[model samples]
Target: MTKALNEFLESNLKELKDNGLYNEINVVEGANGAEITIDGRKMINLSSNNYLGLATNETLKQAAKSAVDSHGVGAGAVRTINGTLDLHVELEETLAKFKGTEAAIAYQSGFNCNMAAISAVMNKHDAILSDELNHASIIDGCRLSKAKIIRVKHSDMDDLRQKAKEAVESGQYNKVMYITDGVFSMDGDVAKLPEIVEIAEEFGLITYVDDAHGSGVMGKGAGTVKHFGLQDKIDFQIGTLSKAIGVVGGYVAGSQQLIDWLKVASRPFLFSTSLAPGDTKAITEAVQMLMDSTELHDKLWENGDYLKEGLKSLGFDIGHSETPITPCIIGDEKTTQQFSKRLMEEGVYAKSIVFPTVPKGTGRVRNMPTAAHTKEMLDEALKVYEKVGKELGVLS
Candidate 1:
């Protein structure tokens, strides 16, 4: 490496370490479920996005095994280049039906799904109004689009309305779009989609919702759009098969025209390899399970509520989370990391969120309570939380 590049890397690494901003990832020993084994210690897991606990579900496992047996493991090419498998087509169709859209297209992952969809529709000639607290993928995707980006305050509908009015009346761009997450992952807040839809309609703007954390958790397991009955109002409904579906992939559900355009215009779909055959089939089975019953969804909400109540009762400042996502705010970055470490020592595996992932000084230990957790597990986790919170002086 060049000397200049070496120096830059060393300085940045030092800065991150000094500021307690560097992340240390823990490797899971086996299947990631309600309980995870990390560093040879079994602990109650509170940090996974497997909301429905379908990642290790026997049904999904068998589906993947069966697909691998028949389809031979890989898709062999990109979607437009004969990579499309029968399993891929079936997954997209199930996604569309579940989201109440006419058609859907899958991508390799959620990050690239945003990259593919945003850039495919918008360009330098257009503008996009995005929520300030939107995920990193959304920010990167907007940058890739080369469109004029207008940062809207987080869920401030009034601010959104004012910005929409200005961007529309200015007539500075040919087309505009408003984008948000169905559920804010960090704070666990739900987006004001109804108001957003009104603003988009008034301004003739496109609507895109990336429900990566909301699918299979909201709208009776359909998502935020269906929770409010706005399936037809939103133009692009994007989701991740990795989260609730507990597999790997992302998708965009919309009208047939939009789907057709993406199949042709989306760069990732045309360039990147398609999702693996086994994963596609497994994702289809998971989505089908979600549609067939709400047992897992209901249980997830119940556990979420139970955990939240326990955390709050213990005097931890769990943030205003509308979903199963719970954030225990710790004001300092190092302290937050320390708290998470202490939790691990006490038999819990909730991770810390520091600068960049969340605003500096608002560091937190975000907990994701899934349906796979039993009441006994939650109780034990809460006991650990009490011990750690008191030891850290985060509670009275």
Candidate 2:
């Protein structure tokens, strides 16, 4: 390595360590589920995005195995060059139905989905009104399109309306699109889709909703837009097969014309290898399961409410979350890290999220209680919280 590069790396790493910003990843010894093993210690896992606990479901596992036996391990080539397998077509069709759209297109991953979807329509001649707290993928997607991006305050419909009016009326751009995450992943608040759709209609702004976190959790498993019954009103319904769907991939569900355009124009679909056969089949099964019953969804919400109540009763500042995601807010960054570490030491694995994942001075240990968590597991976790909170001086 060059001398300058080595110095830069060393100095930056030291600074991060000193400031408690360096994230040390933990390895799960077994499958990620309601519980996980880290360094040979079994613990209640609360930091996963596996909202429905389908990651290790018997049905999904069987589906993946059967697919691997029938189709092999890889897609072998970029989609446009012959990698589009039978499972890909089926998954896209299912996604379209799931999201209540005319058609849908699948991508290799959620991040790539954003990269492909945004640039497929919006261009430098256009403008995108994005939520300030949208996921990083959305931010990069806006940047990649080379469109002028105006940041709307987090979940502030008034700000969105004002910006939408300004961008559309200015006539400086050929088109304007407003994009937001259906569920704000960190705070767990939902996007104001009803008012947004009203504003969009009044100003003729294109509407885009990336419901990655909301896909399998909201709308009886459809998504946040579906939760609000705005399927017909929103132009773009983007989602991930990874999070609540419990597999790995992303998709865009929209009109037939939009799907047709994405097939040809989205760079990831055109240039990247498609999803593997096993993962695709597994994801398809997961979606079907969600569509089949609301047992899991209902249970997930039950557990979420249970955990939030427990944390709140113990005098921990669990933020207001509409969904099952719970965050115990610890004001200082280092203390937040310490709180998470202490939880792990006591046999629970809830990770600390700090700047720039969230704003500084608002550090937190976010918890995700899935349907698979039994009352016993959650009770134990709450006990640990009580112990940690008092010891750390977070609760009196």
Candidate 3:
């Protein structure tokens, strides 16, 4: 039986390798920043989600070190036990204020926050209206909730209204909720919050926004709800400390009642260990920096615009992107993979996104421009892009 199982696994693995679909991991030698060293060679990195360049910021590093000196290391227990430290309380309060919500609760990871928050509130009798293009975390969370899922077309307010209306009219569900990503990660498009809010209100549906990518990038760094001036209307505002905030963990900001219920009901909050002192402190400092100045955020957008314009000028098909996450759309998966390999050989570290992660034909090389990138670095990257494009026949 063991021999048969091993044979089955080997066959599947061989199939993947043969199709060029098997992924090979690359190890980064140091901290993730605008540029990274891989295999002892430094390259201009365009694959990180560290939008505001806070991941390796000096102030955040100092804050983390201080916390480690004071608090030692890990939280000894779960939040429901004795693990809720002063740092955790402080971070939650800070996040509540930042999101303009009444209360907030932190979890082990952004992914866990979704898993905890979604299942804590909605259940099998409930129905979830999710965006087709939402992040994998949101999808997993919704699935965990045991709720009947209804996928609305991506950012289509009319389709959302019709589906939501139909779900409500059925009278079979105990509750209904609409969830979406504030900013879609792959395409960099903003959700139509105003229209979504209006539809939710009309259908009496609870609203949830996972602002993982938008939290430290939009609304002068306040987030997507604040960007649309709809803070008071969104039921749950989910965000991550791992991305722009430069630390690990996630949180859900909402009404005092909702948070109180989650504190008692969420399994992850009750079962999982709390965030470490270092992460809590670093995230707090990052938030303070966002509130203090727009320097980093402005630089991020400046780099984004600069790179986007350069790619367009080179006759490459840069897709429609509202934020800094740009995708160089090369329709064929094999060609896109080849293009990415060539870019790596030329000392640029952009990754190719292929089928399953995206549609099969619309494979792309996604570029995440950060605030730490210099204009000189971008110019060099653009030169390599032009050279690779012509060599690969992607450009005339």
Q: How accurate is candidate 3 locally (lDDT)?
A: 0.92
Tens-digit per-residue lDDT, 217-264, candidate 3: 999898999999999999999999888887889999999999999999
Tens-digit lDDT track of model 2 for 165-261: 8998898999999999999989898999999999999999999999999999999889999999999999999988888888898999999999999
> Distance (Å) between predicted and true CA of 201, model 1?
1.5
Q: lDDT scores for all predictions? A: 0.95, 0.94, 0.92
**Per-residue lDDT of model 1, residues 1-396, tens digit only:** 999999999999999999999999899999999999998999999999999999999999999999999998889998887999888889899999999999999999999899999999999999999999998999999999999999999999999999988998998999989999999999999999988998888889899999999999999999999999999999999999899989998999999999999999999999988999889999999999999999999999999999999999988898889999999998899999999999999999999999999999999999999999999999999999998888889987
Query: Native-vs-model 2 lDDT?
Result: 0.94
TM-score of each: 0.99, 0.99, 0.98
Model 1 lDDT, full chain set: 0.95
C-alpha RMSD for every candidate: 0.7, 0.7, 1.1
